[model samples]
Structures are given as C-alpha cells and as structure tokens.
Target: MSKIDFLVIESDAARAESVVAALQFLGYHPQRGEECLVAEESTHAWRAVYVGGVADAAEAERQFALLGAAAAQVPLLAAADSPWAARLGAAGSPFAQRMATIAFPLRYEALAEAMRGLYARLLGSRRGELRFVGESAPMARVNALIRQVAPFDSSVLVLGESGTGKEMVARTIHECSPRRDKPFVAINCGAIPAELLESELFGHEKGAFTGAISARKGRFELAEGGTLFLDEIGDMSLPMQVKLLRVLQERVFERVGGTRSQRCDVRIIAATHRNLEQAIAEGRFREDLYYRLSVFPLELPALRERLDDLPVLIDEFNQRLARRGLSCVRFGASALQALAGYPWPGNVRELSNLVERLAILYPQGEVRAADLPEKYRGQPQPEETRGAALLAMMDARAPAAAVAPAPAPAHDATLLPEGGIDLKDHLADIEVGLIRQALDATGGVVAHAAKLLRMQRTTLVEKLRKYGMQGSLAA
Candidate 1:
C-alpha cells in the first residue's frame, strides 16, 4: 500500500506548494510538472493530475495533453474558477466532462476535502483488478509476510476466524511461488466425514475399497508438484491426524486398502479458525502434526479491526457485482458511517454478502443508513441498557409541537434586524454543527456525545445518520 502518487500541474509556485502540502498531509505523494510526465508511472500508476489554472493556457494544454488517456481515466481535479476552466470543460473532450472541480480561492481544508473525495472515487475504479483490497496496517503486514514466505516450499498454517480470507492468502502464496504453474488443490478436512477423509487425501487403487470400482487420484496426487490447502485442519480426528503427520514426516502415504506407498511432492498450506493447541492438549490433535503444519503461521485481521478498509472492500464488491450484470449501487455518507461502525463478526465474507444483497435489491440507488438491514443500521448496545435506551428513543420522537422550545440565544435581542430565513435548512445546519461539536468534545465517543446532546444514544445515532455526521462520531 504505497501512498497514491498525484501529479500537480499548477504553474504558480505558491499554489503548487499548497496543493502538494495538502496532498502530502492526506497520505498521498505529490510530484510536480515534467518529473511526473513519465509513461511508466502512467501505465501501471495510481497517478492523478490536479490542474490548478497554470498562468499560461498553452502550458496548461501541453501538460494536459502529455498525460494522454491517463488524464481521462485517472482522477483530474481542477479549480472551477481557473482561467482555463471553461476551456477544459468545453464540449467534445471526454477528459473535461469527467474532471472534478474544486471552487477557487483554494481554502486549505476545502482543497484537502476535495482531494479526499476524489481519492475514494479513484479507488473504486481501480479496485476491480486487485487480488486483495486492504491498505490497513494489518493487511500491509500480512502482504509483507506473504512476499517473504511465498518463495519457500515450507508448510504454512493460516490462522483466522471464518471468512477472514485465509484461503485467499494461501492462493496468493501459491501464485507468487515457483510452483505457481502447477496444480493448487484445496480440501476442507472438517467438511468430509472421518471415514472418508483418508481416502479423499490419498487415492485408492482399482477395487481397493468398497466403492472403488475404478482407480482415482486424491488431492495430494492431483496437486503433485504444486500446493495443497487443507482448511479446518483443527477438526480432524486423531486417527486421521496421525496418518497425515506420517505423510508430513515421511512425504509418502499408502492409499486406503492399497499396499504400494506413493511419494508426494506437494507443498502444504493449512488453515483453521479452531485452536489446534487446545485440541492437542485435549488429545484430539497430535502435537507432532501441529508442529509440522505450523512451520510458518500467519494470522489475518478481522474486518472490524480494520474498519478503515471498508470503503475499498465495498468498491471491490461493487465491481464484482457489476461483472455479474447487477446494477451498481453506491453508499451514501450515512450508510458508509453505519457500515464502519458495525462489528463484523464474520469479517470480509459477511461484508461482501451484504454488498451483493444491496446491489441486487436496490440496484443503482444510493444506500442510506435507513436502507441498511436493522442489525447493521446502528451500533449494537449492551443488553443491560437496551430497555432504557429504547424508552429514551421512543420519548425523543414526540411531536415537534408537543416538545418544549429551548431558551433563546444569550445575545442582545435588538443587536440586528432579521428577515425570514429557510428555517428548515438553518435548523438542520445548527443541528449538524452542534452534533459535530459534541462528538469532538467527547473525543469521538458516541455514547458520551449522545449524553452531551441530551438525547438517547440511539436517538443521537439516528440524527447523526440523518445529517450524514456519523463519521464525526467515529462509531
């Protein structure tokens, strides 16, 4: 996960410095002018170009033309008030139509926000081709470990909760290894019955067993010179574990009911969400087998632990659904916040399922917080306070006319003359401002912020979603 590299084409030195500083602060690496024009960075690049009104229109056109097709696909953010903005927006140019614009005067925070929005959009477009989408520190460390371990033929034990992408890691290892061209086979040891497990792992000769009318090749024989992934190895019976351990120790196994011993040239990658050490202590799994399988161990982080990566996961799922002919759906601001706050017990697989469901049900529509399933629409509360929280939420929804008004602002009554205002927008802005202030004051703790706002936690959570301010609370 290198920071996305952006090219700034501002001819004004001060403006260029400002843009570069803003991008740098937002975790992007910024390059300037001629240095960024290289085609290598353009071909396999996460390159975005920002055109902030170069002093000369000819220089601006030249810079824009140099990027070629990259400018049309990669994110292009221009200042709306720039001298050449209208020309860039002119008809018959696909690049201009696709470009996003920030209003001029270049307010630092505004510029940063615009860049952040653009970055997320760019990520959506690029996520389809990625084998994995996380850029979180946890995933980054996992990727580094994968690169380090892929070249070796030693056994690897992947440990993680179900749906945490353990098999995906194993596949990545195989793809990166020298054995990539050979067969990569997978078997779930727990999914098959104990009686059939041995026969499934090692082939039987013709007429070797009760149902063996023909010779059959098992997983190890099928995999040959490549990799074999044994998932849920922790659930394997002790008898089978002993036999598997023998194969690992001797690299050979006699097929069930067959006398001849066969050599295996396969590399092993085992995965289980169960605690094999506990199983070993209980005499359900062999210590020798555990030691042999865990020659190298890797742990995958749960989705909740890396909530920051949800956006990218959503993007990846969106792309997958689109390829299947489902209409694409986008998450509204509040929907994203709601998703970020959920404790994903089933991890990435669960997230993908939800995204797929949304794509099917609401195809092409923006998913708001209210549109999410009830379980995912709000943060889960503790059982003890659930009743009280529900009561408070019910109380907070009394009719507007029935509710008491707050005290007037503590200012001079005649300080200024006021005309009628759009009361709805004015009050909505005030509510959003106060909610943000309370969240910041509480150090991003939603419970404390809700208390500060004199509302039930659930009520406050609803308002946060209503005003698209859930991100301010940080769940």
Candidate 2:
C-alpha cells in the first residue's frame, strides 16, 4: 500500500530522465543519480527496479541477470524502444513488471504507452521493501565476494589506500562466513608496539613481560572458531612476521613465556594500505607470509575513482547520522557537485571527519560550499598540478552578445561568525559530518560508504569516536 523506492540505473542521460519520470508517475520513490549505484541509502533489498541506457539486447539481458542475483526478491525492468519491443516482458497479471525497452523522444507516444502498461503491472506486485545502498562498482564486487567467501574459511587479504574500508571488508567477510556466529576479533598490527604485538597475537604466560602480571589469552586464542583481523599488517616487524608465519603454517604457537604450544582455529583477515609485494622486495615483510595472508585478496577502490556513487553515499550518511540523533543532516545538489570536483586525497576518513564537523557546527540541513573546507571550496586537484593555461584552454568561450550576468551580493559574516568558533571545534565538526555521511551513504555498507566520502572506514570510525558519535551512528 505504501510507496516503494526504485533504484533506476541508466547507462546514459536519455534513459535516466525518462525512466525516472515514469517511475515517479507510477507512485514510486525513485533514486536517479549515479548509473552504477548498487543499492538504496540504507539497504541491499531492492523494491521494483528498472535499467535504462543499456547498449544492446545482449547487454540488457546480462544486466538483468546481475540484478536478479543481487537484489534478493525485487522485480527488474529495462526501457523498451519500439524497434526492440519489450522482449523480456513478464506474462500474466503481475504486481510488478520490468520494461526492457524504455520510451524515449523518437516516438514519444509509443514509449509512453509502453511505460504505462509496465507501470500498471508493477503496481500489482506484492514485494515492497529493500535495504543496503550505494552504487559503487567495488561495492558490488565486495557484495559478490561476501556471498562467495562467507561460507568457507579462507585467509582474506584486504588491500587498499588509507581510509578505503579494509576493516569493513574484513568484517563483511566474517559476517557472511561460516564463523559468523563466533567471535570477530580485530587487532591493529601497527597500532600496538613491536614488543607487545608478538604476545598479543600469541598469548603470554604469567610474568611474560612488564605488564604480564597475570596469564592472558591473546587475540588468536580469543578468536577460536571465529575471525581475527590484523589491520595494518604491513607495519608488523620482521620478527613478528616470522612468528605470524609459523602460526599460519603450523596452526600452533607457544605463549611468550610459556613453552607449551596452543592450537586455535581462528581464520585470519589481514589488511594494509601498503603493498606487501613492495614491502617484501624491500626485505621488510616476508614473501611467504604475504602469500599466506593474501590467498584471497580483495582490493578496494578509492573514493576518487568511484565518483558515480556520491548521491547514494550522501543518503546512506544521513540515515546513519539520524540514528545518532543527528537527524537533520542533509546535502544539496550544488554542494555534492562541489564535493565531486574536489580531490579527496585523505579518502573516506577525511570526509567522515568533515561531516562530523558539519553536524557539530552547521545546523542539521543541506551543506553548502561555504560550509566546506577551504581545500574543497576551489582548490585544484592533485592531478591538476599542471599549469592553469591548460584549464583555461579547456573552458568553452562564451559569445560576446550574451555577456556575463551581474555577480550575486556578498555574504553577511555575522550569521555564523568564523572568529567565534574554535578552530579545533570547527575541524572536529567537519570530521563528524564526513564520517556520519560516509556510513549512511552505503546503508552502513561501511567500505563503500567510506569510499564514497573519500575515507578509510577505520579512519572514519576513529573520528566518530573523537566526535563522540560512534554509538549514535551505529549501522
């Protein structure tokens, strides 16, 4: 009885405009940004769906198959032009209908007629809700990988840039794996000091070291029958690598001060921003260890590379932030456009911090260019380090007759005085907004959401803690 949110993925502009309008007219809440968008702002379940701008018939069928595999129980549709007809039309009286050929301008009347028929069938379908959002390619891959790897126990290596969501990848794998019911232990291989890491991975007996006043169960032992995540594994020292390798090969390790070996069945999920191959070549990391950990490698894409997912990411961020009582956090079109142009070198973590800062400083509402950092306001991208002459040449020349319009009036500084806000506080607010936004955009699809906001999921998480908004923004 209620309206369903339809994710309309179009390959080109023509299909996007027409399909979205038709969906709207059919009483559906449609999300029409990024063509590669995977899910909605908060979930993986898909309601009624449609695809536009498909290159050809074969491609249309392939796309539909993919949707069927990923969307749980939702109906999928594609635009039907007159030449192609509705080749994949559903038969009988169906509540939801998929239109493979969408109506376009060539023969407006014919297209409209086809769309109306499809809409009528769609409205009769029973399926109504879905979850998991964002449209990033890496996310789709990750989703597929989760389904495949979760049922088995394979060492997973998550490799990516900083703020790219490696930990989230590890978590997703663990959640979907056979050990989902068991513990999911996470330890930062780089965060702990070299002296302590050895003992942390392999439990220490009483009086093992200065703090070993009592016997302790290390992470590996604690994660028995579950998963043990080693974040920033590339940072572990040579000696530690040897110790970890021994455990992986033999599946047994002795405590720091005890000679007795302990056997644990915990699966290892290691992640790092650095390249292990490079580290091995430099003699910093062991080749054998790298191979052992990287048997199933999943490389996450950076936020800059997946610009098509920005809108869904924003929606995902808003949903998570609302959970934390930051209900009014929102974004406007121009602001998002500004975000798309900026180079998010700091990645998703940087974006999360910026969002948190916005939630703290700006009112709960659409963020503007003025509210963003100076670096994003108009700063050149790292790739644009070349001369401005090239940029100028790329700009189209305006006709003399249509001379420029008058500039808008200057902004009044008194409304939110820059001088009054503490610089640290301001920065913190930005961080909070960015983190909150990233988490929400992916429907708590932490990794994809993190990429959308140009941050690593862990980095965003740390900022969430710093801004004291972690619990509030739980996925």
Candidate 3:
C-alpha cells in the first residue's frame, strides 16, 4: 500500500514542528512549507493539507485561496486563534468554506480526531467512484444485484425517488461492469424538450434541422463502448420512448435527418423516480418499452428508509464543503439523534444541502438540536416520552431570562489515577457503554444502532460477536 502524506503550510517554527511530529506519530508523512509552492510539487501524494502561521485574517484568506487552487479537491485544516476564526466567520471569506479550523492551544487528541476524520473523508470521496457507502439490508441487496448482473450486458432499470442518488447507482454499475474503461455518458431525459430530445439521443447530421450547421455525435455515439445513463426515463414522452425502444431492440439508430443506421455498442442504464408501471397501466408509457428497460430492475431506498447511512453521508458532505474552503462542523449527540429521528422527505440531496448550509452558517460550531431549523428541531413521535422529559426539565428550570445555556465541555489533559487502572480495559468499557446506549435507543436494530454510534454495521456486528452480544438484536 502507498503511504499517506500531508501538506503542512506553517511558518510558526514550534507550532509547525508540533503539527509535523503529531502527523508522523499518526503514520502520515508530513511535508512542510511556508507557502503554497509545496502543493504544486507533490499534489497526488498529499491526502490532506494543514494551513497555519498566517499574520492575520487577510493573509490567511489570500494564502488559503492560493493553496486551494493548487490543491484543488484536497481537504484542508487550519490552526488559528479564536479571534482569527471569528474574523473569518464574520468576513465570510472563501477560507470559511474549504478549511476545518482548529483553535490554538487545543489538546493533541482533538487535533488527531479532526485530522483522522478529514483524512477518512478524503479517502472515502476518492473511493466513491467505485463503491456506494451503505451497509443496510437494502444497500446490501443492491450490491448483491450489481455483483450478479455486472458481468452481463443487460438493460438495467433503476427505480428510486428523486435525490436518492440514482445517477450514482448507475455510475457504480458501469464501474463494476466489463466496460469500465470506456466512456460513460449521462443525459437527463426529462430535462430536455421533447422536440429536441431525439437529436440529443441520436446524432444530428449537418443541416439536420434549423440549428444543425455542423454534424454532432449524440449520447449513444459518445458512450461508444461503455454505458449510457438515461436519467428520469419515466418522464420521457411516448414518441421518444418508442424511438428509444426501437434502438434497444435493433441495437442501432439513424441520425436525425439521415438514412443510414449506426451500430450502438453501449450498455443502457435507465433511472426514474416516477412509477413507470402505473404509467403503463394508465396508457401513458408503452408496455413493450417497459419490458425492454426492466430486463433487470434495481430500486434504491429513500434517505428515511436507509437512515443508517446518515453519519457517513454527513462526513461525505463535509468533505465536499472542505473542498470549497469551509470549516467542518460536528453534530452534538442530541442534534444527531434528532436528525436520525426526523423523516427526510427530500432524501440524500436534502441532507447534503442542510450540511452545506450548516458549514456556511455556523462554520466551526458544534450544532445542537436548538441550532437546527424549527421544523427539524422537534422530536419524532416515537420519542414523545423523551420530549416530555425535556419539556418537564424546561418547566422545572428558572425563568428563561434568568437561565443560560451550558457551555460545551472542554477536553481535559490525560491524567493517571493513583490506583492504576488498565487504560485499554477502561476504554473498552466506555465503548461498550456507548454501544449499549445506542442499541437501546435504536430498539436493538443493529444497523440503526451502528449509525447512532457513527460506526459501520459490519464493525458493530464484529464487536457484538466478540462480546457475545449478538443475541441482543435479531439480524
């Protein structure tokens, strides 16, 4: 395996050495530099970047933008004073969108935690092209289908709600298939006008229509030896569906205003959020075309259905925000629980948007339940008793004007007990306690509990097996 590397842009001698030493201890090779030139020298080797030692907010902003351009998609972490973070937050510079800011004098443990999370996020994004991140039963079924069908050249119909990442599923299929090296062209069938959809799908001859001054290759020709993704296929008009069905059947199509048929050596992956079966029953969609498209069907569950993947999804969104130069944010326990309990009607897309919004608004704050919008702050129906307890606590407290919210707890320096304790055993016990709480809160649903603890289902399962706690939850 290749060694992981990091770019350290710091001018503070002691601080720079401290950061480098910590990175080395974590098994990552840290390359140090005073400017952004280091980014250009070893781009691919650096998995992440650390920005420090700026004179003020203005200098930090200018240097961040320069490094951002050099490092493109790599995640960045900045160590700065609280005043600097506050300045950046108020000024609303681009750095607030792309870098995770760690205030000065923080414990090494906190820094390590932040670095690990950022690195994992970057690694996951790099791996996302080939794998979809989820371990729930629904996702497992989808993976199984992909494994079974990827070797064959068959029409795949992917059905899911909008914002459920239909295009990602299509891309995953293409990556898993035999034609992985070839071009994968995607077009939204519903986005284009019905009048021009044909010319877009099938190449247009020179002077084919009013605007056809030059010949052009359509999605099919562009896809050549790989896969063609027809998104929102259910919204495709009947005439266009007929044309597509004929192409699927004959394995060839003629350019618009041209007579000669062109061979199509492309795999078809069509996705739609609409109910095509109902459309067929209503006579709006062709039954023959439905048969042709659904040779193999895959359905992706909505965000609510697969809530177990929320933690990973949030991490993925944070990585995207970091690429844009935003500070990473964390969800408090109450906030995370609230998020998990809420019904995500807009699916993964909505969740991503919300995370990005938080990154922009809060920048570097820990989000609490109260920090969320009104609609999302309320507890779900199943947690009514917990909500009642919270209400009771509120009522028991002093007047609102006399009360103040508690400050976040600070990480204390490591201390040894006079009566020595087994550090490993103590940590193991804490982990067990947290896992038990998660399991109880999730009603012993291992996958849900795994999400609650921000752990992969398989990892949780292994722990459960080791502890002989598998009987606690029915798989």
Which tens-of-lDDT digit does each residue in 275-380 have in candidate 3? 9989999998999999998999999998899888888889878866664446687776556767888888899999998998877666644565545776776643
Query: Please, what is the whole-model Cα lDDT of each candidate in the order they appear?
Result: 0.73, 0.63, 0.72
Alpha-carbon deviation at 308 in model 3, angstroms: 1.7
Q: For model 1, how does the per-residue alpha-carbon lDDT over 1-475 read when each residue is reduced to its tens digit?
A: 4433577788778878888887787777777764554544323244577887578777666666665555656667787776666766678665553456776556654565455444433443422222556889998898888888889999999999999999888877876788865666789999999999988999778888688998777889978898999999999998999899999999999887788889999999999999888888888888889899999999999999899899888888887655333667788655786788889998999999999887867664456665578899784222112223333333435664665443344454334327644445434544554665566666888897788678999998788667555455564
- Record all residue pairs in model 3 with backbone atoms less than 3 Å apart, i.e. clashing: 96-326, 97-325, 97-326, 98-325, 98-326, 99-325
Regions more than 4 Å wrong, model 3: 1-130, 380-475
Give a tens-digit lDDT track for model 2, residues 1-475.
3323566656676767776776666566666535433443344333556665655656545544444433544555555543333444546423134443544553343344344434323332321211223377867776676667667788889888998767766766665566755666789989999998988888899997887898877888868888899999999999889988999999999989999978889999899999888888899999999999988898888889877777776666654454333544555443565788877887766776667677766543456554567777674322122222222322235454444443332443225565464455445444444554455544556566566556688976665454445444546
* Stretches of candidate 1 exceeding 4 Å from the true structure: 1-130, 379-475
lDDT of 3 at 286: 96
Q: After best superposition, candidate 2 residue 151: deviation in angstroms?
A: 1.4
Estimate the Cα RMSD of every predicted model relative to the unseen true structure: 19.5, 23.0, 18.7
Instruction: Output the lDDT of residue 389, model 1.
Output: 30
Q: Give the top-scoring candidate (lDDT).
A: 1
Which candidate do you rate higher for lDDT, 2 or 3? 3
TM-score of 2: 0.53
lDDT for residue 285 in candidate 2, whole number 0-100: 94
